[model samples]
Structures are given as structure tokens and as C-alpha cells.
Target: MADLVSELRQRASALGFDAFGIAAAEARPDLSEKLQAALAAGWHGDMDWMAETADRRASPVALWPEARSVIMIGVNYGPDSDPMAALARRSSGNISVYARNRDYHDIIKGRLKELAGLLSRRTGEAVKVFVDTAPVMEKPLAQAAGLGWQGKHTVLVSRQFGSWLFLGAIFTSAQLPASEPMAESCGSCRRCLDVCPTDAFPAPFQLDARRCLAYLNIEHKGPIPAEFRKAMGNRIYGCDDCLAVCPWNKFASETREAKLFAREDLREPPLSVLLALDDAGFRALFSGSPIKRIGHGRFLRNVLIAAGNSGDRALLEAVEARLEDEDALVRGAAVWAFAQLADGERVRRSAEAHAAGERDAEVRAEWAAVLPEVV
Candidate 1:
């Protein structure tokens, strides 16, 4: 079993995974408790799937009853430059580093399937592969498999890769030797806690996903709450403030995967350009990227929120162009953006003109809400 585990690690490394380990396929009681507590506290926000699949996500055995061993893998997607630098460019939409390139699910899943096939051929064991698509609890499994300890921000932080890892897993009937779990080495670091633009962390190792910028920009389907809009700044797609401030990142290495490298265009896309994208144009721009999943309407809603926070008067025209946008979400965001950039009289004038003709109650409410603020 030990010899097989050693060979598995070597093969996984050869396949381009930065870290690898084996964990016993058993119930994780601690994970079950934590998940239940998170759900009870309503910390998961609109991601109801987390609550729906709680049992399946808690234990590997529950997910795959016949599986005897789990192989957890990590692919480092660390950025070559400071991701936080884009935050200062208020006129540009700051896309999170992970989404600035190809979709990791596509990249990591292919690699995992290839490695699983190789393992099955050698060991004659049946195998199944998963990336982020499934509720397999990869983080805790990765920690149990000795990949890294979960950091204070609740993201896996590796000594070799920091918070820049993309995780995947393979479940098999092979009874491989389990690796020793990594110890939590965070010590007294509070950098990740302090750096959050929105106070997403309720406590150490606890996150309220509802307040998280990443959740608001990505998973959220409606208009962004007015409370978080200012703090969100120019972050359009996802937020990286918490991850970028981790001290462990000093040891992080750039990803060797060519497809994971940050695209120059996406690193800090101009708000003006992103705001102008029609549905067809948006599809062409994102193409194979993960950003395409949100579709053009939600993407534009995020872009308008950034425009409101940009404090750039030049974006006024772009924001105004979206006032009559077919999507009520987009139109609502445009009303808010107009208030942020235009003077009191200008905003009132525009609101009066649009509110009379606006049929959507949500968009009308946005105009009404912003009118008093500007006045």
C-alpha cells in the first residue's frame, strides 16, 4: 500500500499537479458539524445547494459508497503580479486572478481524469474524478490528505502554494495508505481578516458568504445591496483582497500551467469597455473563460456597480446608455451609477425622465432610492 501511494504521488507530480495526497474514504464528523452550523446560521446566503447536499458533501463514503481511498490534488494558479494593484485602478474592473484566465474546472478536471485513468490502469481499481462541480468537500479532504491547512479565511493555504490552489479529487476502490494531515500553522496572523473590503469573516475560520464580495459578484443573481456597493469598489467579477493579503503567499510560486496564466485583457479590464459589451460581444470576449457562465446581464450588473464606485465622470455616458436596457437588473444598476457620477440636479432630471416611463417596479425603486441620496 505504501509503495502504491509513493508511485501515485510521483505520477500525479508528473501529470503537473503541484501537490498530491491520499485520504481514507470515511465520514468526516468535524466537516459535518461545521457545515450544519454554517447552514443553520444562514451564512451560505443564496447558495441553497450547500444546504441541499449537506450529507453528500460531508463524507466521501456517502458520495461514493464503494470508494475505499480518495486522492486529493492541487494545481497552483498563483498570479505572477499583485492582484490587489488593480483595485487602485478605479476606472478598471478588477477581475479576480483565478477567473482572469481559462476556467479551472476545465483545466483541472481533464488533468484529474488523465491521472485517474493512469492509476486505474496500474492498480486495476475503478475510479471517479471530480473538480469544483460536485459537492465533495475537497478542502477538508485536501487538508486530511496533507495538501494544506485551512487558513483563517477558510481557504486552503499551502506552504508551497499559499491560497492560490485549485483543488480536484479522485475516488477509487483501492485501499491506499493515507498521508498525515497538515497542521494549521497560521499562528497570530490577522492580515486576511483585516484586508476584507466587506467584513465577510464573522470569526477566525468562519465566513459569512452573504457579505463576501466574491459571493455578491459571482453567485448573487439580483441587484447588489446598496450597503456593499461602495466597499466593492472596482471589483466586478470576484474579490481577492482576503487571499492576496495572506503572508503565506510569499512562498507561492507562479502556476506552471500555460492555460492558467492571467490574460492581459482580463487583468484590469476598463469599466468603459466592459459596460459597452452587448450579449453577443460579451460571449465572444469571455469565450471559454469562467466569466461567461454569469451571462451578459449579470456581468453588466456587476460592471455598473463598479462604474458607480469608480467616481470617474467619464463613465457617466456609459452608465446612461444602460438606463433603458431591457434587463431590469441592468437598468437599476445604471440608475445607481448615474447618482454616483452626476450632480444632484442632473440625477434628479434623469430619474424624473426615466421613472415615468419605467414599468419595472425594481428599476423604479432604484430611481426613487437614489433621488433622495443625491438631493
Candidate 2:
């Protein structure tokens, strides 16, 4: 069995996984208390679903009691070049590293299943695989599996892989031996906290999702909050400010996962081009990626916020097109974008057009305020 475990690790490495570990499947006894503490403090914000599945998220054993082992693997996804420099060009939208090319879920999940099948064929055991979903605490499980210690950013970080790895796990009924845990190497570095544009982290190992640009752009369903809109700059989809600033990333290597590498079109894509996408256009552009899950309304809302922040006159036409969008959320965001770039006269006209017929009270109020002399 030990030799089998060793052989599996070799296969995973050949399959492009940077690190692999096996964890005995048992409920993480300490996790429930930590989850209760986080939920009690409201660190999860409006992510009410996290609270809904409280028991399962706290431990894998509670999710599937029959599971006896979890095989966790990490795939390095770092690009060869710097991902942060794209931010300096104000006219372009900064997509996060994870979403740069093909979605991680598809890439990692496919490989995890192949490994699961190999294990099942050898041991005649039932297995299920997951990446980024299911009721799994992948980071904590990865830590327990000895893949690596969870870093200050609360992500599983391996010294061999730095912080640029995508994770996946296969749960099996076979009684596999577990691996040893890795010690933390974060030491005294506070660079991740210092780099946050919205001050999203209250402390090391804690994240306030409300203030996280990733959450704001992707998870939160409503308007981009007035306070954070300006700070968002041109980050249309998600923010990588904290991840990009980690000193440990100096050891990061370019990924060999061709599917996970950044597409030239996604790197610093024009804000105008993204803003021009309506529902059909959005569906066409993000067909196979996680971005498709965000839907056009929420995505366009983020783009409009970026368009407002771009401070570039070139995107005014795209902003103008969204002014008449049927969705009040998009129209409200468009009104804000126009206010950022257009003169007072243009703001007045756009605001008035939406003010009378807009059924959404919040959007109407936003339009009223955007009007030049309405104050």
C-alpha cells in the first residue's frame, strides 16, 4: 500500500501536479468551532449560503461519512511573466490570474477523475472527485494532508509551488496512509496586507469578503458599493492584489498547463470591449469558463464600475450603450460611469431619461443624484 501511494504521487507529478498528499478521512474535529467563530463574527458577510451548509463545510466527514481518505493535489498555474503590471494601463480590465484562460474547475477536475479511476481500478474502491466545489474545505484538508501549510492569505501554499497552485481532491473508501503536515514559512512578512487596495484583510489569515475585490466583483449580486467603486480601478472581474504582492511568489514558475495560461485577449482586455458585451455577447465570450457563471448583468455591472474608474474618454460610447439596458442594475451602473467621464450637461440628460420610467427606486435615486443641478 505504501508503494502504491508512492507510485500514485509519481503519476500525479507526471500528470502536472506540483504536490500531492493523502489525508485520512475523518471529520476535522477543530474546524466546526472555527467556522462558528467566523460566522458569529460575520466575516462571511452576505454569503449566506456559507452559513446554510454550515455542518458540511466544516468537515468532509460530515459531508460523506463513508469516505476513508482524501487525495489532495496542487497544479501550478503561475504565468511566466508578471500578472500585476497590467494594472498600470487604466484603459484595460485586469482579470485575475485564476480566470486568465480555461477555468481551473474543468482543468483540475478532469485530471482528478483520471487519478480516481486509476485508484479504483487498482484497489476496487468507490471514489468521488471535486475541485473548488462540493462541501469540501480544500485548504484545510490540503493542510491536513500535508500538501502544505495554509499561508497568511488563508490559501494552501507549498514551498515547492509557491502560491500559484490550483487544488483538487479525490475522496476514496480505501484506507490510505496519511502524509505529514508542512510548517508555515510566512515568517515576518506583511506584504500581502500592505498591498490590499480596499484594506480587505482585518488581520493575517482572515478575509472580510465584503471588502474583497474578488467578492465584490464576482460574488456580491447588487450594486458596487459607492465607497469601493473608485478603489476598484479597472479590475472588472476579480482582484489579485494580495496574491500578486506575496514575496514568496519570487519562486513561482511558469505553468506548463497550457489550458491554464493567460489568453492574450483576457490580459488587459479593453474596458470598452467588455462594456459592449450584452447577454448574448457575454455568453459567447465566456462559454467554457467560470466567468460564465457570473451572468451578464453582474458582469456588466462590474465592467460599468471599471468604465467609471478608467477615466478614459474612449469608453464613453460603450457607457452610452448601456444607459438604456433593460436591467436597472446595469442602467444604474451606466449612470455612474457617465457621471465619471461625461460633463454635467451629459449627466443631466442621461439621468433624466431614466428617472421618470425607472421602476427600481434605488436606481431612480442614483439617477437623480447623477443629475448636475438635482442636488
Candidate 3:
């Protein structure tokens, strides 16, 4: 069994997995209580799937009773430059480091499938693989498997990789030796919690998805709440404040996988360039990237919020152009962005021109909400 585990470790590294570990299928019996607490607190916000998949997500054995051991692996995706520096360039859009290239799910899932094949060939143990599309809780499972400890900010942090790991898991009926769990190493550091633009952390090791910009920008399907708009700044896709400020990152190096590196165009693309994208243009530009999944309406809405926060009057023309957008979400965000950049009179005038014809109650409400402020 020990020799078999050693062989699996070598194969994982050869396949480009940066971290490898194993855990019993039922190693963490406490997962159900923790997941239930988060759901009870309503911290997951609009991601209803978390609640829906709670039973299966409790542990590997719960997900599949035939599972006897689990394998966890990580691929480091450290950025070539400080992700925070992009925030100072207000006129440019800032994307999360992970999404700046091809969708990682596509990249990692193929590798996971190949590795699983190797395991099945060796032991004839039935294998199942996951690259985050399922109910299995990869982060906690990775901690159980000793890849790294889950940090205070609720992301995995490795001594070798810091907070920049893309994780995957393989489950099998083989009773592989479980690795020792890594202890929590954050100590007294509060940088991740303090740096959040929207106070996403309710307490140490606790996250409120409702207040997280990443969730709002990426997962939430409606108009962004007014309070979070300015806080969002120029980040059109996801927020990286907590992940980049980790002290453990001092040991982190840029990724070895070329596919995981940031694309120059996506690293800090100009907001003006983003605003000019029609649906076709948006799709073509982000063809293989994860940003394409948000669709054009949500993309435009995020860009408009960034434009409003930009304080660059140059974006006013583009902000105004979105007022006629067919999607109510896009039109409403344009209203807010226009209010942010244009003078009071132009805001009132634009409101008068468009408010009457706005059939969507949400868009009309957006116009109504801003009217009183100008007067």
C-alpha cells in the first residue's frame, strides 16, 4: 500500500500537479456541521447550489459510498506581477489572476482524467474525478489530504504555493494511505480580512458571500447593489485583495504551467476598450477565457460600475451609450454610471429622455432612485 501511494505521488508530479496528498474518504467527519453553519448564516448568498448539494458535499464517502480513499492535487497559478498594482490604473479593467487565461476547469479537468486513468490501471479500483463542477468540497478535502491548510480567508494556502493553487480531486475504492493534515499557519495575520473592499469576511475563517465583490461580479445575476458599486472600483470580473496580500506568498513563485499564466491583454485591458465591445466583440475577445461565461449583459454591467468609479469623464460617452441596452440589468447599471460621471443637469435630462420608455421595473427604479439626489 505504501509503495502504491509512492507510485501515485510520482505520477501526479510528472503530470504537472504541484502538490499531492491522500485522505481517507471519511477523514473529516466535522464537515457537515461547518457547511450547515455557513448555510444557516445565509453566508452563501445567491449561490443556492451550495445548499442543494449539502448532503453529498459533506464528505467523499457520502458523495459515493464505494469510495474508500481520496486523492487531492493542486496546480500553482502564481501571477507574474502583483495583482494589486492594477487597482491604481483606474481606467483599465482588472481581472482576477486565475481568469486571465483559458478557463482553468478545462485545463485541470483533462489532467485529472489522465491521472485517474493511471490509478485505475494500477489497482483496478473504480475512480471518479472532480475539478470543482460537483458537490464535493475540494478545499477542506485538500486540507485533509495535506496539500495545504485552508487559510483564514477561506482559501487554501501552501508553504510552497501560497494562495495561488487550482485544486482537483480523485476518489477511488482503493484504501490508499492518508497524508497528515497541514496545521493552520495564519497566526495573527489579518491582512486578508482588512484588505477586502466590501468586508466580505464576517470573522476569521468565515466568509459572507453576500458582501464579496467576486460573488457579486461573477455569480449574482442582477443589478449590483448601489453600496458595492464604488467599492468594486475597476475590477470587472473578480476581486483578489485577500489572496494577494497573504504573507505566505513571499515563498510563492510564478506558475510553471504556461497555460495558467496571465494574458497581457486580459491583465489590464483598458476600460474604454471593454466598453466598446458589442456582444459579438465580447465573445470573440474572451473566446476561450472564463470571463465569457458571464455573457455580455453582465459583462457590460460590471464595466459600467468600474467606469462610474473611474472618475474619468472620458468614459461618460460610453456610459451613456449603454442607456439603450436591451437588458434591464445593463440599462440600470448605465443609469448609475451616468449619474456618477455626468453633471446633475445631464443626469436629469437623460433620465427624462429614457425614464418614460423604460418598461423594466428595475430599470425604472434605477432612474427613480437617482432623480431625487440630483434635485
Candidate 4:
């Protein structure tokens, strides 16, 4: 069993995974309770899938009863430069480091399937592989498999890889030796908590997804709350403030995967350029990227919010162009962005011109909400 585990690690390394570990296919004793507590507290926000898949996510054995050993792997995606620097470029959209290139789901899933095939061939056992698309409780499983500990920010933090790892797992019937779990090493560190722009963390290791910029910009489906727009700064797709502040990142190495390198165009795309994208243009720009999953409407809504926070008067024309956009969500965000960029009288005049023609109640309300109170 020990020899098999050693060979598995070597194969994973050869396949380009930065870290690897193995664990028994049993439930972690505390996972079900922690998941229940998080869902009960409403910290998951509109992510109803967490509630729906709670039972399956609680245990690997529950997910695949015949599985006897689980293989957890990590692929490092550390950025070459500080991701926070893009936030300061107000006129540009700040895409998260992970999403600034090819979609990790595709990249990691393909590699995981390859690894699973290797395992099956060697052990003559059936195997299954999963990336982020499944409800596998990957963070905890990674920790249990000795990959890393879940940090105070609710993300896995590796002593070698920091918070930049993209995790995947393989479940098999082979009874491989389990690696020892890693102990939490984050002693007396509050940097991740203090660094959150939206105060997403309610306590150490507890996150309120509703208040997280990454959740709001990515998973959220409706108009962004007015309160969060300003705090969002220039972050359009996902935010990286919490992860960037971690001390363990000092030991992190930049991703060796060429496909995962940040695209120059996506690294700091001008708000003006992003706002000009029609559905076809949006699709063309993010063809194989993860940002494409949100579709053009949600992507535009995020861009408009960033435009509103940009405080760049130059974006007023771009904001105004979306006032009558086909999507109500985009129109609403445009209205809010226009109000921020234009003066009170100009906003009022534009509102009067568009309010009568506006069919969406929410978009009309945005016009009313941003206008100065009548004397």
C-alpha cells in the first residue's frame, strides 16, 4: 500500500500537479455539521446548490459507495504579480487571477481524467474524477488528504502553494494508504479578514458569501446591491484581496501551466472597452474563459458597476449607451453608472428622457433612486 501511494505521487508529479495526497473514502467527522451550520446561517446566499447537495457533499462514501481511496491533487496558479495592483487602475476592469486565462474547470478536469485512467490501469479498479463542478467538499478533502489546511478566509492555504491552488479529486476502489492530514498553521494572523473590501468573513474560517465581491460578481444573478457597488472598486469578475494578503504566499511559485498564464488583454481591460462589447463581441473576447459562463448580460452588469465606481467622467457615454439595453439587469446597472458619472442635472435630464420609455420596473426604479430628491 505504501509503495502504491509513493508511485501515485510520482505519477501525479509527472502529470504536472503541484501537490498530491491520498485519503480513505470515509466522511470527515465534522464536515456535515459545518456544512449544515453554514447553510443554516444563510451564509451561502443565493447558492441554493449547497443546500441541495449537502448530503452528497458530506461524505465521499455517500457520493460513491464503492470507492475505497480518494486521491486529491493541487495545481498552482499563483499570479506573476500582485493581483491587487489592477484594482487601483480605476478605468480598467480587474478580473480575478484565476479567471484571467483559460477556464480552470476544463484544464483541471482533463488532467484529472487522465490521472484517473492511469490509476485504473495500474490497480484494475473503477475510478471517477471531479473538479469544481461537483459538490465534493474539495477544500476539506484536500486538507484531509494532506494537501493543506482551510484558512481563515475559507480557502485552502498550502505552505508551499499558498491560496493559489486549483484542486481536483479522483475516487477509486483501490485501498491505497492514506496520507496524514495537515495541521492548521495559521497562527495569530488576521490579514485575510482585515483585507476583505466587502467584509465577507464573519469570523475566522467563516464566510458570508452574500457580502463577498467574488460571489456578488460571479454567482449572483440580479442587480448588484447599491451598498456593494462602491466597495467593489474596479473588480468586475472576481475579487482577490483576501487571498493576496496571505503571508504564506511568500513561498508560492508562479504557475508552470502555460495555458493558465494571465492574458494581457484580460489583465486590465479598460472599462470603456468592456462596456462596448455586445453579446457576440463578449463571446468572442472570452471564448474559452470561465467568465463566459456568466453570459453577456451579467458580465455587462458587473462592468457597469465597476464603471460606476471608476469615477471616470469619460465613461459617461458608454454608461448612457446601455440605458435602453435589451436586458433589464444591464439597463439597471447602466442607470446607476450614469448617475455616478454624470452631474445631478444631467442625470435628471437623462432620467426624464428614458424613464417614460423604460418597461422594466427595476430599471425605472434605478433612475428614480439615483436622482436628487425633489424640493
TM-score of each: 0.97, 0.95, 0.97, 0.97
Of candidate 4, the 10-residue stretch with the lowest lDDT total is 252-261
For model 2, give the 10-residue run with minimal summed lDDT.
251-260
Of the two candidates 2 and 4, the one with more favorable lDDT, higher being better, is 4
Q: How does each model score on lDDT?
A: 0.89, 0.83, 0.92, 0.90
Question: Relative to the unseen true structure, what is the C-alpha lDDT of residue 6 in candidate 4, on a scale of 0 to 100?
Answer: 80
**After aligning candidate 3 to the native by TM-score, how far in Å is the CA of 187 from where it should be?**
0.6
Model 1 TM-score?
A: 0.97
Model 4 misplacement above 4 A = 254-259, 372-375
Note the clash tally of each candidate: 0, 0, 0, 0
User: Across residues 129-151, which tens digit of lDDT does each residue of candidate 1 receive?
Assistant: 99988889988889989999999
Which portions of model 3 show Cα errors greater than 4 Å?
Answer: 254-259, 373-375
> Could you give me the TM-score of model 2 versus the true structure?
0.95
Backbone clashes in candidate 1 total 0
Candidate 4: residue 205 lDDT (0-100): 97
Give the alpha carbon lDDT tens digit for every residue of 267-366 in model 2: 7888878887778989988878779998999998988988888889988988988888998889889888988999888877766666777788768767
Which digits, one per residue and each the tens of the lDDT, describe model 4 over residues 157-235? 9999899999999999988888899999999998999999888898999999999999999999999998899999889
